[model samples]
Target: MGHLSTHVLDTTAGRPAAGVAIELRRLGADGSSEPVASTVTNADGRTDGPLLEGASLQAGTYELLFHVGAYFARTGAGPEQPFLDVVPVRFGVTDPAARYHVPLVVTPWSYSTYRGS
Candidate 1:
């Protein structure tokens, strides 16, 4: 079975970004979006379970909206006006049978992500 997972790491603090809000959305062909899942990161900065798995996982474009601004505000880790607000990591899922691990390594000024095993 395939699955989709994510985690947030605060590069500034050098720790997992716990309590970050994440929204998973499936992109439509016409540019519309459909909400797939929404959850907050646990203490380990990971979802309790795969956001999407098994039959729900599909081959298409998806977006993970990481609410970094709110997270920063709550943690008092970022500036009053954040340079990087709600960070959106958008990518394609080509194989439904493969595991998709998209992680966000972020700071108040920047963020990075990649396909992981």
Candidate 2:
């Protein structure tokens, strides 16, 4: 019954980071990374479906890669030299029966994330 989800908010613009590209990757047993799913943020800056569905949810280390640089550039929020290029948030899933919500609040110069409901 484990589930994974995420949301992104552009704090500088006071709105959701719409159209942002996100990649969900799982850490393989061989210490390499594998893509689990890829998605784009909706107008609400959230995935329309569960990031990890069905048997994909497991107890392990995973990464959420946020393409902040491209988002900023497309939105014209920052110049060519953006503060954050690719933001990678890594965390552990200790329980396969639990639901994980990783929410990211980001700006041109900074970003933060936390476990959400």
Candidate 3:
């Protein structure tokens, strides 16, 4: 079976970004996006459940919205104006039978992500 997952790490803190808000969206063919699920990161910076799995997994574009601003604030990263607010990482799932682990490494001003096991 296929599955979708994510993890967020606060580069500034050098640890998992716990309690951050996350939204999973499936992009429609007409260019509109629909919400797949919404959950917050656990202590390990991962969702408590698979965002998508099995029959729910499809071949298309997906978007992950990470509310990093609130996370930064909660972690005591108080900047006058956060350079990076919400981070959106969009990627495609070409194979429904593959496990997509989109991990995020983020700071107040920057973020990066890639396909993982």
Candidate 4:
């Protein structure tokens, strides 16, 4: 079975980005997106469970939207006029039987993500 999971790291704080809001969405052929799951990061910067697992894993394009603005504000690091607010990560899942660990390394001004182990 395949699985989908994620984690967030706050570059500014140099720690796991706890309490960051994240959303997983499936992209349709007509440029529409459907929300699949939504969750907040834990103390370890990970979701409580795999966002999509077992039979729910599908081969297609997906997007992960991170509420960077809210997260920075909660951490008392938000700027008066934020440069980077919501961060969107879009990628494709080609093999449903594989594990996908999408990780976001972020700060109040910027962010980066990659498919991890």
Candidate 5:
């Protein structure tokens, strides 16, 4: 079945953005968001386990919300007025048998993401 995972890297610090909060959400039929799961990045800037694993995954739209602002502030990498705040990356999952890896590379001012293996 489909699985979801993510990793975070702090481009500004040139390291992992550890202890960052992340939320996984599924889009509801009525066009609203529903929480599927929530997790915080580990010291390696990765989820302790799959965000959504085994039969929990379904083919649909999903969103990963990263709390970059708070992470940067807490880590003393940037001030409250950092360039980037909350960053939301959304993508569609079409294959239930596939593994989906969404990796985020971010700094206080910018970020990037791509479908990873």
Candidate 6:
């Protein structure tokens, strides 16, 4: 069955972005969304388990919210007012049995994401 996972890398520090807050939400067709999961990255910059898996994962649109500002604040990095705060990555799941790994490579000033293994 399909499952979802994520990782965060602190490009500025050249290491995993530990302690970053993350939220997963399933988006509805009516511009509404419901929370699916919430977690913080561990030292390895990954969630302890797949965010969504098996029967719980369906073919649909979803959003992953990364709290970059809070992470920088807690780590004592970045400017007082970070240019990039909460980064929202929205994507669609086309196959129910495929694994989706969305990883974030970020700094206080910028961020990027792509579909990974």
Worst 10 residues of 3 by lDDT: 74-83
- TM-scores of the candidates in the order shown: 0.98, 0.95, 0.95, 0.96, 0.94, 0.98
Query: Candidate 3 or 6, higher TM-score?
Result: 6
Cα deviation in Å at residue 27, candidate 1? 0.4
Per-residue lDDT tens digits for candidate 4, residues 1-117, read 899999999989999989989999999999999999999999999999999998898999999998889888877887977777889999999999999999999988878888999
**Root-mean-square deviation (CA) per prediction:** 0.6, 1.1, 0.9, 0.8, 1.1, 0.6
lDDT of 1 by residue, 6-91 (tens): 99999899999999999999999999999999999999999999999998999999999999999998889899987788999999
Measured on C-alpha atoms, candidate 1 has an lDDT of: 0.95
lDDT tens digits, residue span 8-113, model 6: 9999999999999999999999999999999999999999999999999999999999999999988888899888899999999999799999999999999999
Deviation of model 3 at 115, angstroms: 0.4
Task: Write model 3 residue lDDT over 1-117, tens digit each, in one string.
Answer: 999999999888889999999999999889999999999999999889889999899999999999998889877884867778889999999999999999999999888998889
Q: Give Cα-based local distance difference scores for all models.
A: 0.95, 0.91, 0.91, 0.92, 0.91, 0.95
Q: Between 2 and 6, whose TM-score is larger?
A: 6
Clashing pairs in 2: none
Clashing pairs in 1: none
lDDT of candidate model 6 versus the reference: 0.95
User: Tens digits of per-residue lDDT for model 5 on 1-117?
Assistant: 668999999988888889999999999768999999999999999999999977888888999999999999998888768777889999998886799999999988788999999
lDDT of 4 at 15: 94
Better candidate by lDDT, 1 or 5: 1
Q: Candidate 5: where is the Cα deviation over 4 Å?
A: none
Candidate 6 least-lDDT 10 residues: 74-83
